[model samples]
Target: MKKVIIVGAVGGGATAASQLRYYDKEMEITVYDRDTTMSYAACGTPYVIGGVIEEESSIIMATPEQFQDKRNIDVLLEHEIIEIRRSQKQVLVRNLATGKEFTDSYDALILSPGGSAIMPEIDGMDGHVFSLRSYADMQAIQSFIAREKPSHCVVSGAGFIGLEMAENLSHLGLEVAIVHKSASILSILDEDLSKILQKELLSHGIDVYTDAVIDKINGNTLHLSNGKKLESDLVIMSIGLKPNTSLAEQAGLSIGVTGGIQTNDFMQTDDPFIYAIGDATENDDFITGDPKRVPLAVPAHRQAFIAARHITGNPIAKKGLLGTSILKVFDLDAAMTGLTETQIKEKGLLAKTVVHIGNSNAGYYPDHSKLTLKVHYNPETRQLLGAQCIGGKGVDKRIDVLATAIYGGLTIDDLQALELCYAPPFSSPKDPVNMIGYKAIE
Candidate 1:
C-alpha cells in the first residue's frame, strides 16, 4: 500500500486523486489544500460576481466530505504544506485553522499549487482593489459590490479575465472603463481584431484607454500614467498570473523559462518520486515543442490524468499543449489556438496568414451573424500552425474544429476537404472554415 501526499486540491490535484483511485483502489491518498473551498469552478467566478450564477454553491463540483466518502481518500482543507523535505520524502504541514504543525510522509508526492494573481506595486491601492483567482476572491468582489453599490469601475489589463470582469461588472449597472497597459485589448488576438473589439466596447458605452497604466490611487480616484485621472468606485487588477513555484524551487526542482516548475512528459520533476502539474508546471508546446505554461483548466485536467497513470504503472506520454482558449466579449466570441502571427514572427518562423470574413451561416438564413477567421500556416511545409476566430455564432464550433485539425497534424489545404455539417440556420454550403482553407491555397 503506497502512501501518496498531494498538495493543493483544486483542479489538478483533485483530478489526480480521483484518477489514481480509479486505477489502484488500495493506495493511500491524502490531499491538503490551504484554501477552505476545493474542487470549484474557478473560471465561472466572473459570471457569479455578475449574478449570472445566482449562488456560489452552484460552482462547487465536490466537497471534501464527498471526496472522502465516495473515493475513500482523505481531503484536509485549511491545511497548508509549509515545507517539502525531499531527503525524507515528507512534507511539513500546518493546520491553518488550529495553527498546529504536522509531518506527512509519502511514497510519492504531487504538487498542484496552481497560481497567484499578479498585483502590481502601486500607491494607495489599499481599498476596493480586487483580483479574481479563487472562490474566495470572487466572494470578496461580490460582497464589495453589494455593500458599496459602486457605480463606476476601472479594470486594469485587457486579457481574458480582464475583459470578462469588465463585461460582468458592467452587467451590474456600473459604468465600466478598461485601461490596458498594451496598445490593444485582448492581446491574444492581432491588432486588427483588437480594433474591432474596441469598437464594440465603445458602442456598449464602455470607455477604452490603451497604452496606459495605473500610477496611483487616491481614495476613489485613479491616476493613469497616460496623464488621465479617473474616479472609479471599484478597481479590478487582472494584469496577469504567476505560477506559485516557490515550493518546488525550495525543494530544489528546476524552474523553466516560463516561470513554471520543469517537468518531463510524465509530469515528474528531477526527483523521480515527486511530480508537479497544473498551472505551476511547464510542458512542451504542441506546435513549437518549446517549454510553455498553460494555466487553462482543460490542460490541467489532462496533465493530471497523465501523472496518475504514470504513478499507477500505466504510463502515457503527454501529447504537448496548443494553449487553446476562448472568451465572450459582449455580442462577440473571441477564440484562438496555437500561436498568433506576432508570436510566429517573434520566433522567426516563416508563416503565411489567410483571413476570411463571411457569414456564420447561409446569408439567406434569418439572424445570420458575421464571422472573421484567420489561420496561420508554415509557407514551406503547408502545416497549420495556429488560428483565430471572432464571430457572433459558431465561433466555438469553428475554433474547436481548427484546434482539432492542428492536433491531428492537418495541413492548411486539408481544411478544405473537411465534411463539416451544413444547414440553412447552422452553416453555409462552404463553411467559413472551408473558405479559409480555399483562400490559403490562393
Candidate 2:
C-alpha cells in the first residue's frame, strides 16, 4: 500500500488527508501536527474570546479519535515534522511531548503549514500583548480577559482580523480602540468605502485612529507615532500574517516572491513527490496572473482538493485566486473580490469604475437599508476586474454573484443580463448588480 505523510493537521492538511482517503481507500495516510488541537475553526477564535462562542471546544471540527475511527487515518497530534529528506522520501518527526525523534517514510508528502501572526517590533511590548493565530493563542486571550477583566483594549491594525477582533472585544463590553498605520481601515476596499466603515466603528463607541503606528507599549499604555498615548489594559496585534515556509525553505523547495512555496498547476512543488497547499503556498492571481498569497480558508480548502486529486492519479489545474473576501464591521457587511481600483491604476491598466448607491431591496420595502456597489472593468474589453459592496444586507449575495461572474470570465455587460431573483423583500426589478451594469453603459 502507498504510504502518505502530511505535515500540519489544520484546514488544508486535514482536508487533503480526507480527500486522499476518498480517492484511494487502501492508501496509508498519517497526519502530524505540533498542536494538541487539530481541525479547529481558527476564524471563530475571536468569537470565543468575546464569549460569543461559549466554549472553545465548539469550534473544533474534528479530533484525532474521530479521524482514526471514522476515516481510518492516523492523526498524531503534538508530533512535529522537523526535517524533510527528499532523497529518501522520509521526514524526521519529533514527539514534542517526549523529546524523541523518529523517521517516517512516505510515497507522497503534503505540506500545509499555514501561517504565523506577525508581531511588530515595538519597545516595551513584553506586557499583555496578544496575537490570535492558533487555538492556544485564543485560549490565552480568553484566560487573560476572564482573569484580568481588562476594561480597555487597543487593537493594532485595521484589516479583517483586526476589525473582527475589535468587534468581538467590544461585544464583551470592553472599551475598544483601533489604530491603523494605513490611511484607511480595511484596505481591501477603497478609501471612500473604508471611510464609511470608519464612521460605523466610531458610532459604536470604538475609537478609530488612521495613519498611526504603535511606537511603544509601556505597561498597559501604548504610545503612538502620532504623539498620542492610549491607556490599554491589553493589546491585540492583528497587523498581518507571514506564511510558515521555513520547513519548505529548509527542504530546498522553490519559494515565490510572495514568500510562499512555489507550486505548479498541480499543486506540486519543485519536487514532484512533494505537494504544498494552504497559506504556505502561493498561486497565480485570477485576473493579473501574478503570483499571490491568499491566506483565506476557502482557498486553502480548494487547494487541498486539487492536491489530493493529483496525488490519486487524477489531475486538475488550479484556477487562480480572486482574493475574494468579506467581513462584518459592527452592523455593516463589507465584501470584495478580484483586483481593486488602486491596484489597476498601479498596474497602469486602462480601467473605468461605476459606483451605484441603491437599496438592498425595493425602496418601498420596509427596513430597506442603503447599499453601495462599486465595480471596476476594462473599458476596451469590458471585463470585470473587481467589485466592492458595503451595506446592512445583501452585500454577501452580490459579492458572491460578482465573484462567480469573474470566475466564469463574465464581462460587465453580462451582469446586466443576469437573471437575479427580484422581490420586494429581497431585491428590486433592477437589482443593484444590474443597476451597476446599466450605469456602466451610460
Candidate 3:
C-alpha cells in the first residue's frame, strides 16, 4: 500500500485525502494542517462576517473526528509541515500547540497550502486591521466588532473580498466605504461594466471611491493621496493574495510564470511523484492556454480529484479552467467566464465584443430583473471567446451556460442554435445567451 501524505487540509487537500482513501483503502493516508479545525469552507468566511450566517461553526464542512471515524483518515490538527525533503521523501512536521517537531515519510505528496491575503504596509496598520482569509480571521473580526462597536469601517480594496466586506459591514449596521487603488472597481470586469457596478454599489448607500489609495491610518482617520482624510473606526485590507509557495520552492518544485506551482494536464508537478493542486498551483487557461492562478473552491476540489485519480492509476486528466467566477453584493449578482476584453486585447488577439441589456426572464414576467451580458468573440470566425454577466436571480445560470459553450469551443452560430429550456418564470424563447449569439451573427 502506498503511503500518502497531504499538507493543508482545506478544500483541495481535504478532497484529495477523501478521494485517495476511496481509491485505495489499504493506503496509509495522513493529513496535516496547522489550523486546529479540519475541512471547512473558507469561501463562506465573508457571509459569516456579514451576519447573514449566524453561526461560524456552520461553515466548517468536517471535523477532525469525522475524518478519522468516517473516512478512516488520520488528520493531524495543529500540525504544520515546515520543510519538505524531496530527496529523502520525508517532511519535517511541527506541532503548533506543543512546539514539537517530527518527520514523516510518504510514497506520494500533495501540496495545497493555498494563498494568504496581501496586507500592504501602511502606518497605523496593526491589530486594528483585518483580512478575511481564514476562519480565525473571521472570529477575530467578529470579536473586535462586538467589543469596539465601530461606527465607520473602511475597506481598503474593491475586489471580491473587498466588496463583500463592504456589504457585510453595512449589514452589521456600520457605515462602510470601499477605497479602490485602481481607476475602476472590480478590476476583474471590463471598465465599462465596472461603471455599471459602481452605480449599483452607490445605489445601495455604500461609499465607492476609485483611483483612491490610503496613505496611512491614524486613529479614526484615513489619510489619502489626494490630501483628503476620511474618519473610520476600523480597516479591512483586501488588496490581493500571493500563492504560498515557500514549501514547494524549498523542495525544488518548478514554479510557473504566475508564481504558482507548475503542473501538467495530469496535475503532476515537475517531479512525477509529487503533485500540487488548488490555489497554490498555476493552472492553464482554456482559451489562452497560458498559465493563470485561479484561486476558487470548486477548481481546487476538482483539481484534487484529478491529482488523486492520476496517482491511483485511475488517471482522469484535468482540462484547463475558464476561470469562471461569481459574486453577490446586496441584491445584485455578477458572474463571468473565460477571458475579458482587456485580456483579449492585451494578448494581441484580434477579437471584438458586444454588450446586451435584457431581463432575466420574459419581459412580461412579474419578477423579471434586468441583466447585462457581454460576450467576446473572434471577429473573423465569430467564435465565442468569453462572457460576463451582471443581474439578479439568474446571473449564475447564464454564466454557467456560457462557460460550457467556451469549453466546447462553440462559435456564435453554434450558440444561437443551442437548445435551452424556457418558461415565463425562468427564461424567454430566445434566452439571453442565444440573444448574444444572435447578435454576434448580426
Candidate 4:
C-alpha cells in the first residue's frame, strides 16, 4: 500500500519506476515529466539527425500506454512537478497541458531531473543556435537540416557531443567547422591521444579550430575571441551540461560541490524518504572519492535501481563511478574511463602514464589499424587511475576491460594477467591491454 512518486521520465526516473514494479508488485508508482512524451533514448539523437535513423519514433523505447498496461505505472507526460514539500511528503504538480496544479502525496520520492544543455549568451544568436538535449531538440535540428539544406555549419565545442555532431553533420555533405576554447579537442583523452583524434577530424574534411571561442554571433557569422570570423548556415552548441538541480535546490535539499544533489550511499537526500538519481545527483568518483557529476545514462540507471531497492527495505550502498564513455567519429572510435593524466595532475597527484601503440589485430591480418592506448596509473600504488583508447576497431572493447579493472581496483600489472581472446581478425597475441601493462613496467 506504499506509493512512490518519481519526477522526470527518462533515464533514471523511468528505470526506477519500472524496476519498482518488479520489486514490489503492489507499490503505487506515478511518474511526471515536463516533456510531453514518454521515455526515449537520447543517445541515438545524433544518428537521428544524420539520417542513420530514418524515423525519430525508432529511438523511442517505451510509450505511456505500454507502461500503464504492462507495468501498471501511471505516466503523466507534460505534468511538471514544480515544487517538493518534504514535510508533507508530497509534491506540487502542474498540468502543463491544462495549466492546473495539484498535490501528489508519496511515501517515497525520487528526483531525476537530468541535465540541461549549456547555451552560450551571445549577441545575434537568437534563432541560429540549436542544442540536442530532448527529442524535440533533435527533431528541430533534423527539420532545419532538411528544410534549409545548409551548406556550411559551425559547431561550438569539441567535446563528445560536439565531435559526434560534427561528424554526423559532415556526413550529410555539409562543410563543418568546430571552434573550441581548449587547446585540444576531446579533452577527456590525454593531450597526446587527443592530438591524434584531432588529426582524424581534420582528415575527415572537418575544420578544427583550437584556442578559439565565440565572442558573439552576427546573423550566421560568428565573431571569435581569437580574432577570427566564421560564417555558417546554422550553429550547434554542444559545449556541455550542468546538473538540473533547480527543483531539488528549491526544496531545501543540499547541493554538492559538483552542482548536483548531495546524497548518501543509499542515494538518500537529507530527507530519508526522498532520493535523488541520474545527472541531478553527484556521484562518488572511484579514483579520488570526490563528488563528480557524470551525466551518463548507465550510471544514472544503475543508481535508480539501487535507490529503488533501498526504498523497498533492501538498502544497498551506491558505489563510486569511473566516468566511462565512448564516441565514434567517422571511421574512428574513441572510449575512455576513470581519471585522465591532466585530471591527476590537477589534483596534485603523480600519475605514471604509458601509451601503447599496437594493431587491433595481428600485423599480418588484412583489416588492421594501429590502436593507441593510453593508461594512467598511480606512481606508487600502480593502480589504474584512467585509460584512453583511439582506433578504428577494438577501442570500445579495451576501454570496457580497463573500465572494469578500475571498477575492480585492479592495478597496471593486473591487466597483463587478463586472458583476453586473441585471433587474426580480433586481437594480437600480445593484446594492447597486455602491452599496456608491459610498458608500465618499463
- Residues 1-442, model 1: lDDT tens digits: 9989999999999999999999999999999999989999999999999888898798999998999899999999999998999999999999999999999999999999999999999999876999999999998998899898999999999998999999998889999999999998888798898888888888888899999999999999999999999999899999999999999999999999999999998999999999999999999989899998999999999999999999999999998899999998899888899998788989999899999999999998887899999999998899999999988989999989999999998999999999999999999999999998899885
Most accurate candidate by lDDT = 2
What is the lDDT of every predicted structure here?
A: 0.93, 0.94, 0.89, 0.90
Q: Runs in model 3 with CA error above 4 Å?
A: none
Which residue runs does candidate 2 get wrong by more than 4 Å?
none
Question: Candidate 1 or 3, higher TM-score?
Answer: 1
lDDT tens readout by residue for model 4, 109-203? 99989999999788888766898889999988988888888999999999988998999899899999999989999888888888888998999
Worst 10 residues of 3 by lDDT: 406-415
TM-score of each: 0.99, 0.99, 0.98, 0.98
Candidate 2 per-residue C-alpha lDDT over 333-399 given as tens digits, one digit per residue, 9 for 90 to 100: 9999999878888889889999999899988989788999999999899999999999999999999
lDDT of 3 by residue, 114-135 (tens): 9999888789886678888888
Could you tell me the lDDT of residue 99 within candidate 4? 100
Enumerate residue pairs that collide in model 2: none
Q: How close is candidate 3 to the true structure, as a TM-score?
A: 0.98
